[model samples]
Target: MQKLRQETQGFGQAVPPAQSAELIHTNTISRGTKFGFLGPAVISLAVIGLAPLAFAIWTSLYNYNLTKLASMRFIGLANYANVFSDSAFWQAMGRTFTLLIIALPVQIAVGMGIALLLHRPGIGFLKTITRLSLVIPMATTYAVVGLLGQVMFNLKYGVVNQLLGFTGVSPINWLGVPEFAFATIIFWDIWQWTPFCALVFLAGLTTVPPEVEEAARLETKNWWTILRNVQLPFLIPGLTAVLILRTADTLKQFDMVFTMTRGGPGSSTELISLLIQRVGFRAFDQGLASAQAMVLLVITIVLSRLYIRFFYREV
Candidate 1:
């Protein structure tokens, strides 16, 4: 019994210590490898993203005007104070949010409808063709889209006006008028982005298990009921991704709007982004623009946090 016990103890002492040492060594190597792989990316982010952000914050503290570089002096929080007091800044912010409020829901609805249509079981070739068509708008660059909008929405020689002429309706100055111009911006955004949302939702739909869908259909012939109860759970992740991406994109929307309107028609489409551009470049008030940009950054972070906290769901 003593011999058996000693052998067991020896076995345990020898095997466990050796295995433990090997495991510890492996863990150290794993950690070192992970850090090694991550080092370059971390350095790049610090250099590219954090450095600029720090510079912007520093620049915001001064009365930096490009026109009067020699007169540039530190003004502390005065630029931020000016931003809050500026009516134009507030108006621009209002216009920005108004676009987001009006456009997001329309895009989601239209995109979801398109996704549902595409999700229906159909001829394989036709489905491929239809799905490929959704990529057309998404593949177009922002600048190209803006240029296309100019040609399509032109007052006289535009395709839109030509179509209106068929019904004996007068050519509407789509981009020249303030109200129509804003609507045109919304329309262009919708046209460009709806396909993206549709594709995302379609991917989500594809994840629905065949057995689960079959069981769901057996329980109810109502498509809405099946979609709500059986399929929506699978869509949560995709929906979250779409919401985050679209929200960020819309908040920073500059290129297309810049090309299309240049905040024209008497500042009608002067969104916050355009306001920042005008202040920074046109007015050459670098400090105020930096302050405005920092404020926008804060707003974006807060809104993103709100979306993640309230709507994000794992599936």
Candidate 2:
């Protein structure tokens, strides 16, 4: 027994122990290594990231007029007060969140389904074609999508009505009415962004082992069963990433909606972005705009941080 113990000790000493402190330390990187050199780079990025935000906070407290920079006065919380009091600002914010409620789930589900289809083997050409189609919409300029959407929804001669005309249904105003305009923006969002969500899920799907999928096939189950049991667990990380990204992007959306509807009809579809732009540039109310922008920035940051922390902790 003593001899056997000695041999085991020798073997253990030759190989690093599971709980060894030295084994826990990864890599043998030197102090002079390139990664070590990134200390300065990290500091630079920290400064860059925080500087503008600090400036915005400072400016939010002051009355900053680009035309009269010298005339700027320190008016703490007044701008913030005005923004809170503005009924239009609240209305626009309500509409923005409403859009998110309508669009996020559909985007995620449809995108995941598409990604699943693309993951199947022996369909290389189909995957390529589908990816190309999805990429085109995402790559299209925001302004161009807005313009095209307007053209397609034109009340006078819109393609939407032409299609409905074939079904003997009355012509529907796609953008002229408040509800229709709101729905139009939501549809545009789904069209342009579902591809991005799908791309993320597709990226995740590629990392899944083929053997696992083959095993799932051997179970003699339907497609939905395989997807629910096999695919979804693997896609948790990717879905978390997509949700966080889409949430942030949807909240800050400006160019597409403004160009398409410009907060039209009665402020039914007016988003917080349009409201901030109006206060900042159009009305020359920089202080109020900055305050509103700060409010928006805070909301997004809080929500994103919470999402990352809670759902995407590993992300």
Candidate 3:
């Protein structure tokens, strides 16, 4: 037994226990190195992103009117209260939400269809041209699209009305009525952004394993079933990402609505961003604008979080 114990001790000594303290020291050094590399980026983010947000929050807390600086009194939360009570503000919010609700599903469905078509095999030269064409609308500026909308939707002599004349339909005032104007904006948004969603979906399609898809095809032989059960599951991540980004962007949409309609006819097209711009710049009520902006920020964050929670529950 003593001899066996001596042999075991010798076997143990052959390798020697690893130096845990040395390993810990090396890990600490690596962590420090990573942080050293990341420090500049962290500082830049704080300066550029966080600093502005902090300033906005601070401004929102105080009654800091740009025009009435001398009379500006710190009325905590009064501006927020006023925004909640304002009828025009509520109207703008309702319109904004209405547009979002109408546009989101249409964009997602059309974009996904486009992506599926583009991803299919057996396309050579056509694929390249199709991709390039789809990219053109997304590449164009929103302001440019809005300006084009203004010209194209003109009542009397616009190309749209002229096109309708061939079918014996009378010239429709595309941008004159509130409903038509809102529809025009939604259509413009869908046209410009559907390609973006398609691109994202296409990228997600690439990540799906081809073998798995083949296996599913063999099992069912029904393309729709495969798409719903296999392709759609694979697309959830891309869909979630597109939804979050588009929701935030659509909520803050200003340039297109501003350029096309100027929130006019009767403030029927006024989105929250337009309202904020009017309050801050036109009305010179910076405090109220800041308060509104803060509320918008909160709403955006909450919506984003809810989406993330719902979509990413598995993760």
Candidate 4:
């Protein structure tokens, strides 16, 4: 027993507690190792994301117009003040919101309907193909969609007017007239994005447990009742997600307007993004454009937070 105990003590002394702990610690990440792993990510974000943002904010504080380089001076908050009081800027904001108000609901409602239609049990191969086809519009480049809209709404030779001729109606200026131009853009946006909203809602439907749905069906005979009280409750997260994304996107709309109307027909379709582009690029007022962009960024963040707070987990 003494000999065995002596051998055990010798084996234990071979590696001290401190040495064992050090070895274990080395196997895991140390503070320096963690920093090594995260250093590239931090540096990349600072250089790529934060550097431009800091530059833009700094530029916004100055009276930096490209044409009048000699007149450049630090006029703190003057650009922001101008953005608030500028009538054209407000008009552009109003047009952006107007399009959002009209298009958002239509997209959500149509998309939700399509999702419900496609969310049945045991989806077949043909139905799967049909669902996959919906992605084509969403996957198409927005620039391409804008160009397509330009061709489709070209008053005289457009397909829409050509079709109207069959019904004995006169050719109407789709993109030339202010009201029609606005409507045409809204229609084009809806056509392109409704598929995306449908996909989101359909994914939400899959997350709804079959047992929960069965329980709800047992309580309610009406399909509308089940939809309103059961399915919609489970779909809130998806609905809120789509709403926030669409709102941000619609608020910053520029590509379609730029390609199709160029904010023409007396600035009827001048969205906030188009206005910012014109101010920064066309008018060479970099400070004012940066300020406008900051305002847009703030609005997007606030609205997204509001959506998350109100509808995220309420269901």
Candidate 5:
């Protein structure tokens, strides 16, 4: 027993000093190698993201106008104050919120319904085709979608008007009138993004354990009950992602609204993004635009945090 105890103690003794030093040296090299691999990505982020943000913040503190570059001077928070006081800015923000309120619920509901349909057992070929079709709107460029909206919603020559004529209804001025134009934009957004939400929800559904679903079905005949009690928990992550992405996209909606309406029919459809564009480019008030943009960034970050806090769940 004494011999065995000595052997065990010897085996458990600290590593040789030379070997320990070698191990430490090897660990240092490994850490250095890891940082070396990460160096390019860190540098790229600094160059591509932080630099522009810093520049924008700096520009926001000055009275920098693209047209009057030589007259540019530091104005501190004047631009930010001006933005908050601008009635047009508030109107644009209100319109943006209106769009968000109207569109998000409809998109979520329709998308959830579509996801439920797609989740069911179906013909393999049909399922594959349906899934592929959902990608079409997402794959289409935003600018192209805007242009297409213009062609399709024209006052007289539009396909929509022609179809309405066949149904004995008057050809409505879809894009010419303020209310119709806003509604048309809403419809356009819903059409383009519902599939994206559907696909995301479908992905979430796919992760649900089959045994759990089967057990739920055995307990409840009401599909709604099973969905609420069993399936929805799995969908929280996807729902959170959809909310965050869609909210951000809607707030920054410029390309489609710009190409389609140009914020026109007399500023009725002027969203916050369009307002920023007009201030920065048309009015040449770079300082004001930068301030507006920074305010918008803050709003986006706040809303994203709220969504994550309330809805985010590990799946």
Candidate 6:
């Protein structure tokens, strides 16, 4: 073995052939091990995620109405085209996006502030308590949350209007008014999502190497400078993740707005989802409902792809 190694390296160099052979054998086995090792995960993902997506696409092509079974017809791209002409569908798409725009920035800002406060070394106990407290809202069921939102925004006896009444302010129809109704939904979404974003920021903070933060503090006492230059840079990837996740979630805002207003007081706060439900079930226009859904699906897919490409491509 020594002679074989010497011959392969140089006249004076020596190594065992057995060690070289073992290394080569290990490399060969690893190289030949197919990623078929991921078979289960791939299969599970397809069954749970991809299969449903394919099924939705197929259903979108057909007039799959829940009520009028005889009226259901295979309509090809007719539903897809009808989406463009449907004013209600477009309005809903707008509402969903408007909520996203209002919620994402505010939630991200609040979450980062909390995470920054929590990341401080002196506030360990406070951090633990605050984090646990925030988790409660998240743990609460959506239905319950919606119910609470409705009660809170109630024009007559709701606590919010009651609080305003204390200051001699008129008890506005909080849920009935379009402006404040929209605002109410935005607030509810932010309250629920901010903590989640903070959790992401906290994860990013933990990964910042200790020595780097220490060196920054040593150089200067300017907290803002150090945070922007050091911590914020390190947190960009995490920030992107939080933004994308929250944006996607906000697009699906339904129960809170639905339970509170039923898209009433003049359809001012009516969203596409609620519109589709009304058409499909209430109005009994299944084809129109299907078309609206297809449009929604298309918009969601387009935006999701854009976010992935713009922010999460490297990840």
lDDT of 4 by residue, 84-197 (tens): 999998899998989999999999999998998888766688679979999999898888888888998898888989999999999999998999998899899999999999
| lDDT for each residue of candidate 1 in 49-95, tens digit (9 for 90 to 100) | 99999999999999999999999999999999999999999999988
Evaluated at residue 304, the lDDT of candidate 6 is: 71
What are the runs in model 4 whose C-alpha is more than 4 Å off? 1-28, 121-123
By TM-score, highest first, what's the ranking?
1, 5, 3, 4, 2, 6
Q: Where does model 5 exceed 4 Å of error?
A: 1-31, 313-315
> 3 or 6, which is superior by lDDT?
3
Write model 6 residue lDDT over 164-238, tens digit each, in one string.
999999998878778888888788888888888888888888888999999999999998998888888777789
Candidate 3 off by > 4 Å: 1-36
- Compose the digit string of candidate 2's lDDT tens values, residues 1-315: 344334445544432344443442323233345456887887788799778677778888989877778889999999899888989888888989999988999999899888878887787888798989989888999878888888888887989888988999888888999999999999999999999999999998877788898998999679888877887777778887887888888888888888888878778778999888887888877878889989999899898888778776543
Which candidate number has the best lDDT?
5
Q: Tell me model 4's lDDT, rounded to 2 decimals.
A: 0.87
Q: State the C-alpha lDDT per candidate.
A: 0.87, 0.82, 0.84, 0.87, 0.90, 0.77
Candidate 3 per-residue lDDT, tens place, 1-315, comes to: 344334434545322235432333333333445678888899999999999888777777778878778986778888889988999888988888888898988989899898889888977699889888889998888888888888988998789899999999999887889888888899989988999998889888878799998899789978789888888878888888998999999989998889889987688789999999999899888888888898888999999999999987743
Candidates in order, TM-scores: namely 0.90, 0.82, 0.88, 0.87, 0.90, 0.81
TM-score of 3: 0.88
The Cα error of candidate 2 at residue 222, in Å, is 4.0
Candidate 1 residue spans exceeding 4 A from truth: 1-27, 30-32, 313-315
Total clashing pairs for each candidate: 0, 0, 0, 0, 0, 1
Q: Candidate 5, residues 259-295: lDDT per residue as tens digits? A: 9999989998999999999999999999999999999
